[model samples]
Target: MSKRARLLAALVVVMTVFVGAPADADRGISVPAFYTPPSSLPSENGALIRSEPLPLALSLPGLDGPLPGRATRIMYKSTDNNGRPVAVTGAYLEPTAAWKGPGKRPLVVLAPGTMGQGDHCSTSLALQRGLILGIGVTQSTVSIGYEVLAAYRLLAKGIAVVQTDYVGLGTTDRLHTYVDRVDEGHAVLDAARAARALTGTTSDVGLYGYSQGGGATSSAAELQASYAPDVPLKATYSGAPPADLLDTTTAIDGTELVGAIGWAVNGFVQSDPSLKPLLDKYLSDAGRAALKDLSTMCVGDAIFAYANKKTSSWTTTGQSIADVLRSEPVARAYIDGQRIGTTKPAGIVRVATGVNDNLVPHPQARTMAANWCGLGGDVVYVPVDNVKTPSPLLNHFGPLLSDQGTAVDWLAARLAGTPATSNCGALPGQ
Candidate 1:
């Protein structure tokens, strides 16, 4: 067996123990509804695990569609962001017209924001994957749950949706790199590819994500041109994207969300070997335990517990995770590498940010836009402002849910071959 396979098997065993279910009884790990795939997949050691594609007859009546009709589900497998083989069991909502209309259909790659995965957590993979079905969390009434309403938006529009369970969260592996670009990007793009294989649809592709999803979309977009040139990417809609990891780290350091960020960084280090040793010394027993516990935590649980609090003072006195990271050249190099868009962009890109976002600050988005422009990337930067709340400040996690119409419209224009203005106003090094 490959190293990845061994790792996957190990994770599955660990998850089974934590969830208190027999291996055979656990069919698959459930992900957020929006990010959930249609198929039920068994856990595997490889990054991309395979399962029977979800049956296409599930009915959803709440959300309107880009197209009108029944949606279908399928199971697929692909490499995680780190090239580990894994399974991505998700559904594809397709408008009834999509079948007869044309040989091609535009694709919407939906990357879900945070959802918890602790053993006791409601959004745990055990819950997301159907091991525990009949969940009361309805599609429209999602609080900290994985909502599948957004998938319908693309399906109704005659576009196929591709969603993945990422690596460890769904099936029990190591970590979910909340916003780490590479691994998240791979899962996002791989889902798109998986969708294409199932439908054999050949049309322009568009990317859409919010919060951590934004970071995944950004990673996929930046890498699309080089990684999947044949994808014919049309546009990317990233809401509150964590574009600059380093900048975001600095912005959220020592705050409540610091632990959540640290959890993600732990995943990043494992996926990115270069960052491991740099941060190894600072990971106290408590910190490591927290990371392990958080591996299965959904986004809501992870962030709610640590949003405004400072980092735990349990580590060696006077030492912080940041301090340790800063002292390591390998960690610094890896962090700096993600500051700009390194991979070639496949099509038009839209980057949205909430100016007052305490989670991922507007400045980080601005800096990312600037860096993209400096690298000659095609990008559109949008800053959301609400008249009542704050003119220039958009809620960190609210824009995608509230103003998806705007984002969808922008993607529609791009699909129609319209040009998008790049935010090159402040280029890097200016």
Candidate 2:
């Protein structure tokens, strides 16, 4: 790692020490039995497997629970892209705040941003333990439950939130399918089903997410028509969605999250065995080691270990990930399969992007909106042009924090039977 990277890591370590939070007791070592998938799953997609009440790690006065709502750790049946029944784990948060909307209530699957590949890094786990400070012999896996901020906002509005841990993040059976279009979309749609099973609430649904979550929700919106036709998907709030992974890969290179390239590689290869040639032919031994390390790391450990590193060092030929994609037609085609916006998203959709976000990039997200507009879909384009951060990761995050309120509000209105207008009609390049 570079000197600057080491310094960043050290500074964070020092911050954790000063904060004085106790180290995670057993989570640092083994995967709990609760995370284990059933020996045989039910054939129906979105079938409820089991659930148990989960305690939120964060607490405050006047709140009935540690959170603004009640949380449950749930495992549900969901199919992967390859047509196999997979046990997907997630959390269902029922708000204490009463629903003042026009209908019974609405449930929104809050697809989380990139939470990393470890069971310890799951959003469901994070919700229970607000901040996990994992102190391993080699390194610590750290992830603050930042998704709670958005979940709290929705809960305050009396909307129920079901957060998916994706296909494998918490579940020990498989590696987290980082952003496989089919895997992510199916996990999210099934989370809605899991929520309904837990509460038996016949409520309309909305999808909300940012960054990786954005990609998942957007994918779910498009897939809902066929995949989960029973789901009453009312609207989707997609923030900084990586509609095109090729562009996203190029954009993420050399940033703090450059290690994410490895996450994607590990996921793609695991999901499609045909891509295993990539491991032997292209990746160097050091690259393989990095993938092993990242396989179980959370975002904090990832940034600490691989900050600002480039992918050139990972390849035998010293070629960047961009180069590998350019050189290998099969690899490029496989990644292209992860791209969103191929079909117009069903129902009202709000697509927001940071104009200066080079991390996920701004153009691909805009392209999704344009594609929806061309298809005569109800699309509202919200460009968060107000802020720019010098740091690439922060630049991508800026829009999410700034636009989350409006995004939630838009979803709330749609859930309350408001007719969503299409700004695509007046927008340029539509």
**lDDT of candidate 1 over 120-197, digit per residue (tens):** 232223223322322222110112333344554555455666665554445433445556666667667776776667
Off by more than 4 A, model 2: 1-29, 61-67
Q: How much does candidate 2 score in TM-score?
A: 0.92
Error of 2 at 201 (Å): 2.0
Model 2 lDDT at residue 263: 86
Per-residue lDDT of 1-430 in model 2, one digit per residue for the tens? 7332342243333322112223442226455689989899988888889999987664333335433668889999999999989999999988876789886989999999998987778888887766677665645667877787788778878899999999999998888989889999999999998898889877999999999999999999999999999999999999999899889998898899987888888899999999898778988988888888898887877898998998888889999888898779888899887889888788989999988999999999999889888977789998888567678999998888788878888999999888878899666843
Q: In terms of TM-score, how similar is model 1 to the real structure? A: 0.73
Compute each candidate's TM-score over C-alphas. 0.73, 0.92
